[model samples]
Target chain A: MHVLRPLYVVLALAVIMLIARSFWVPNDFGTHEQGYTYGWYRQSNVEEWKNFTVKYRGKEFCGTCHAGQAQKLASAHHKDIECENCHGPALFHPADPLKLVLDRSRELCLRCHTSLFYPTSQRSQIKGINPDQHNLGLECTLCHKPHEASKPGRRNR
Target chain B: MNRRDFIKLAMKGTAVVVLAKGLDGIFRPSDVQALATPLRFVFLVDTYKCIGCGFCVKACKLENEIPFDADVSRTWVERYVVTSEGEVFADTPKEARNGFITGQIDLGRGKFKDIPREKIKKAFFVPKLCNQCEKPSCVQVCPVGATYQNADGVVLVDRKWCIGCGYCIMACPYGMRFFHPVHHVADKCNFCYHRINHGLRPACVQACPTGARQIGNIKDHGDPVENIIRTQQVAVHKPEYGTNPQVYYIGLGEEVR
Candidate 1:
């Protein structure tokens, strides 16, 4: 009888909790919106998820201001390439448009055009040239244009 | 009460307890309607196309607000170089900064020591992220219902509900789950759920220079992922575990884990 008394109390507590849960649990809780988890958790996760502030605003963002450059890039072989890829990230462009520095260095071009150590099948084949043999000391921009580095004897777009 | 009467009462109590256990299934959340359709999300990583540039790692870190710590990265690139003698050296440098070629191999267990490249066989870069499994072990083990999978099959952790018990971290077979250094809660990749829900690619995919990483819904026949899966031989990591990982690999060699 003594053991049964505690069992009865436990049963009563269990029944009360079950009833309270039905009332306390949100209607949408454990539903599809919450993925059948705790109801309050769904609400919390939704509120926590916020749009991340975009840092690299692709070519589309750059094209908004520099329409002429955007138009030129569209017709060139480098049309698909992003402006920030070469010019560097312009996070504060509109506020400080001067921040977009022009990288006319030969190393910048070699980063992609150089004969990389990677296998021929893997690395992109753009006329692979040994930097030491071709230009020696001359700048890449001196002979090849930055925007459209077309093949030899090909007409620039 | 008499001994016989007490036994009868105990039997009745046991029966009620058994019935109560069965009732939980009846009370399961009806929101399973969210998964009514066979929604499929495919993440394809082309090992051949990756150049080990680590731009994707940089982009993911910036976009996700992850601190600049080598150990706390959400996504990382591993470079595997095989030797002529069949020796394999695998290493992941600090964000693959100077590329995958320049890193020492000391992961405590000394899995693969650094070997000089003169006797090289073949080298490749493998990028890794959370699998977003269909039957996520993390979701099944979460006692507080913190980890869950959405209707579209993206596994996510409810940060607020997480009890920091570290069960999900241990449950994940891919070793993708990590206790967030700052938040002190279990965190892993959700395929950029915040961005994908808004029709944007994940930061890593967007930042990839070689178009090595591709993600799309396989449910839509018109989607490129569906065509790729049909045309190319796609594979998931550790299929024997039966986690049903959504991430697929293209050009995955036998050497890769």
Candidate 2:
């Protein structure tokens, strides 16, 4: 009976640890709105995560150099979007900026402009062309310039 | 009772009481899972509108700083083309890393050589991500309780405590969860929790040029999410699994997996 005293103390300590854990963990774990939570884990030190170097430097970065194209893109449908969204990331941008790959494929235009099986009401109100009927086997840039794709007077076809 | 017996019973009773009191707050039933507040974030994916441009994929990779790997990406676009003979071919090669345009491009491993349009009867793109279920299996299977459904109804992984057990990865019915290549912990889309908390759209939604993706508070009446759910016919990926996925799809073809 006397020897069992240590075992009982160990069991009690284990129970206490379990109870402490229940209190230590956040209440919102797996619960909605409190956000995700972890139990007894070290927090990710993300103090420096706020201002890390990024690949895509936004439209302003490109606009600084190619003021002519930037000015034209500003008046187009893609005004709100970034230049790097289509042109790829501008990591070595200002140093060797002219080497940017120019994508003038019709498939690129169809990516956003071609309407398919989506409910018409839910689709973007922008007019889409049926590939087979409109400008078949022709480059999209032949009719529409990349900078001013939807501008009224610039449309050829 | 003897003195010893009385002491043992008292200790057991105290332990039980303390445990019940302590766990009561954490282990409450999630019956109010459908939004205790007026804010219910809903993700709408229009399969008809998606053109497999892979812009959303690139945006998510950049926004989350996730290394772009086909197997470990937060989101991927699937291209489904049905033949006139009723044969369906679906593939997501490198999550369309270079954008699915005609020309010289290495479509590594998956051998996703584009089938000519003349042989295809119909084709469309379906973008996939974590469904963020109401009763998420990933959350249930997480041994360490690392994965949890947040208040915004988004399922997220607490990377800090995750043991990299990969249990949640297997448990997810939609096959959304994956082990982060660098972190070695389970990772998946949380509807971009870091951005959405700041009152901005998720990276995928913001990057979609065709307006194929939209996220709105379903609780708000007349909101686009609510209006679509009320007026349009939307379907979830797998309702039979009973995951109750939050991602509602419009024009989801029968061929989509």
* Runs off by more than 4 Å, candidate 1: A1-28, A31-47, A50-52, A68-116, A124-157, B1-35, B101-118
DockQ of 2: 0.18
- Candidate 1 has which clashing residue pairs, if any? A30-A36, A31-B31, A32-B31
Q: Tally clashes: model 1.
A: 3
Residue B251, candidate 2: C-alpha displacement in angstroms:
0.6
lDDT of 1 at B76: 84
Stretches > 4 Å off in candidate 2: A2-6, A9-71, A77-81, A87-145, A150-157, B1-26, B32-35, B102-116
Error of 1 at A142 (Å): 12
Q: Give candidate 2's error at residue B213 in angstroms.
A: 0.6
lDDT of 2 by residue, A1-157 (tens): 9999999999999999989988976553333333233222122312122233445555676888889989988888767556777776676666755476656767766665664432323223445666668768999777676777655335745
lDDT score for residue A151 of model 1: 46
lDDT tens per residue, model 1, A40-107: 24544654563545556677878899888888777766664567656755666778556776667665
Kindly list the per-residue Cα lDDT of model 1 for residues B24-82, writing each as its tens digit: 54444433234355566679899888877676776677667676664777788877777
